[model samples]
Target: MTAELLEFLEELSRALIASGNSVTDTERILWSVAESQGVEVEVSVLPTMIIIKAEGEVSRMGLAAQSPGMMPLHQVTEIYRLTDDVTSRRMEVGEALGELRGI
Candidate 1:
């Protein structure tokens, strides 16, 4: 898997966590999002963590704390924009990572 794709997944997982979704739900949503972006991946989500397996070789996992709170619409919109930009090659992974961190 490409580094850019990996970075995208990581940021997306973070976004979902920030949105107050359970890790399992985040995994499901992220799988759909990736597919919508024309990327295929295998994901396994536990209550406290998410595991993504890509191209049968690369795997990435993220551990999330349990912080349940509503995410503002504007923040979610920004995340969607970031996903679009990176997936469409309009932005670099590093740049997107920086933006996501700020969010």
Candidate 2:
């Protein structure tokens, strides 16, 4: 299921590029689709990048195993939000450092 989802995002990315759509416009379209599909995405914009995450209230979202009785952290990074569009992408210097350290 995840592989299929990744493939779908890749194709969607390609189509967005082919259509000459800007990232901002793409995000708007993406939000519209997500709303209809019952997925919630929160966009955090940096100077030249955007981070997408699933929406949760002030409570009820986290990392960890997510088993019925598992406890998760309150930290944001550990939580993951699925991305439906891959056309919008960026990497961070801190993440690069973590990769360098084999984290």
TM-score of each model, paired residue for residue: 0.67, 0.35
Say which candidate scores most in TM-score.
1
* Whole-model lDDT, model 1: 0.72
Among these predictions, the greatest lDDT belongs to 1
Q: Which pairs of residues have clashing backbones in candidate 1? A: none
TM-score of 2: 0.35
What C-alpha root-mean-square deviation, in Å, does candidate 1 show against the real structure?
3.1
State the lDDT of candidate 2 residue by residue for 39-96, as single tens digits: 5666432223334455552212211112233223321122112222222333332332
Across residues 1-103, which tens digit of lDDT does each residue of candidate 1 receive? 2556666687678677777667677777667656655678887776567777766657888875545677889988888788778667687667877888888
Q: Which regions of candidate 1 fall more than 4 Å away from where they truly are?
A: 21-39
